[model samples]
Target: MPRRGGPPEVNAGSMADIAFLLLIFFLVTTTIETDAGLDRMLPPIEPPDQDVVIKQKNIFTVNINKNGQLLVEEELLDLRDLRARAVEFLDNGGDGTCNYCRGGKDASSSDNPTKAIISLKNDRETKYATYITVQNELVGAYNELRNREAQRLYGRNFTEMEAEFLNPETPASIRDDLKDKVKAVQDLFPQKLSEAETSASN
Candidate 1:
């Protein structure tokens, strides 16, 4: 159909350009989310081919019942007192085995730090909080000993030396030295927390 003098037909090519620009804008504005989880370092794999006998007297047993109760050495203990007791047990050098051990030679308790084993047992229904708290106290006892040894050897706290060793900004030479210091501290107070399964009665 012909009209008198029509203006002109609008070109449809520019519309495609507008739609492409909108697609680019949306792509630029989009964001992607990621899942997060707790960072826990797992223990090294150990072969069960070897068997070693652990003396009964040398073992300090900690039991957590389903009622969220702590029984250390068969005696119910308060959470506040567990750390000090653990310290005493670890520091005792009864058998003349640990020269650096400062533990009281209580005939009824562990013979030496080397022989002292902190055996933790928990029922299947035990509270996680109770088990975690006991574990924390035991670890704290070991750290306390390690820190003391580090101070004696390096004239600094264990944490300070460890920080320097792990710091990304630290010089390679200094970090290497700190690494040895950290190892020395850990060797002095070797963590011996052994976990065992237990019956509900315990």
Candidate 2:
């Protein structure tokens, strides 16, 4: 009897397993995409063991509204003068002995500039641009302070070379030193300014 020749039957049962294995292999080997978010330092969640009282003497308040109006210590101030006033507040009562003290030849006196609190308040309808502008001004104030401190430290004005030296590409030790100096000043300024003024007429 001539048996009808038929192609050898291929086993399809293992094909599913093979496909699954390949899928899993690729899943394991492939790089997963993750969202890169904003880089910011967050406060610690754990409560501190010791109670610390923050003094408000050196605190500086800055308020902004939906209309982009600026206020410093309940006084309306122009954006152009923001940096100057911040420096002035920090430099007040200069004896060259206090950490927050300014207006002296000593470098360390003007270095840290004690704590400053910036109270940002805006209406629900405030534009993002206005908020960002206010933030930029605050950052500008910090930079000015940093430059002034660097000048005081080097015992001379910030030259082009000194400015370049402050770059992060400099030596790790030097960069770290500058970073610490900036961090010291940056930490003093809080992101949220508490004393937000309402538009209601007094």
Measured by TM-score, the strongest candidate is 1
Task: Give the per-residue lDDT of model 2 (tens digit) for 65-174.
Answer: 66677777789989788877766655554334455345443332223245445555656555667666666776566566555655565443333334545676788777
lDDT per residue for candidate 1 within 20-101, as digits (tens), equals 9999999999998864432234668987778888778888888888887889888999989999999998888777777887
Clashes of each: 3, 3
Q: In model 1, which residue pairs have backbone atoms overlapping below 3 Å?
A: 91-103, 92-103, 94-111
Q: Model 2 clash pairs? A: 118-193, 119-193, 120-193
In model 2, the number of clashes is: 3
Every candidate's CA RMSD: 6.9, 9.1
**Stretches of candidate 2 above 4 Å error?**
1-39, 93-100, 103-112, 155-202
